[model samples]
Target: SGAVHFTRNNLSAYIRSNVRYLVALLVAGFDPSSGPELHYIDPFGSSVPIRYGGHGSGINFCTPIFEEFYKPTLDKRTAYNIIQKCVAEIQKRLVINLRNFDVFVIGREGITKLDPINQVSLRAQLMGNPPPRK
Candidate 1:
């Protein structure tokens, strides 16, 4: 059976005991046949796969962005494109002092860190400007 495991933090444990509540969530697991998986855990601790997941102060404003551009069959490049576009909207419309973002890629080879997305790159893409020379 290809059941996805969705485990959440025992919230009752937090209310009864003084377990330190952390805002950030880490979702990781490996399926022998289906390969590896990662998720963004919500405050309630549900670990489910999502095409797009956001936490923090800008979620309300960010929903529209995801709604317009999200696709289920997105490859790596397309996924990053959506994320970049969302961040661009976030910076302009939302009040968060966001500057850049870090990207991490997961695959059969394991997780590999990628370059951070900065304001300059977003500006170029959003404005249709050419990429700067390496």
Candidate 2:
């Protein structure tokens, strides 16, 4: 009934209400009282706190991995690794060609785009087309 619920509820509702909110969001940011927080909002309007989540065709391929490995206190590097794995699995399993992907993180400062995944990289890593430098 205070700051926490208000902020959480507002975010959930806003996400659901958006016209093209057909995608899933792995959202992380800070709340005035709660500090750093993470949530997964799906196309179906369910917003949930989670250490890991995925959506669309990727969910079917990557959720089991998250189920086995997700931890509440994920370090920054580990979180990036998990996302990469999800991308790889999705690209490998799905026929759809994903051209690019963006990774965003919301921290004390604000939302920042960390790094991006490209088609070339995905093909190299997951499709066995050719390897990128490790």
TM-score for each predicted model, relative to the true structure: 0.68, 0.62
lDDT: which candidate is best? 2
RMSD of each: 4.2, 5.8
In the range 28-84, model 1's lDDT, one tens digit per residue, is: 555567655557655555556655567767776677878887775566666677777
Model-by-model lDDT, in order?
0.64, 0.66
Candidate 2, 21: how far from true, in Å? 9.3
Error of 2 at 75 (Å): 2.2
Sum up the clashes in candidate 2: 0
Error of 1 at 22 (Å): 4.9
- Span of 10 residues, lowest total lDDT, candidate 1: 1-10
Candidate with maximal TM-score: 1
Q: After superposition, how far is residue 54 of candidate 1 from its true place, in Å?
A: 1.2
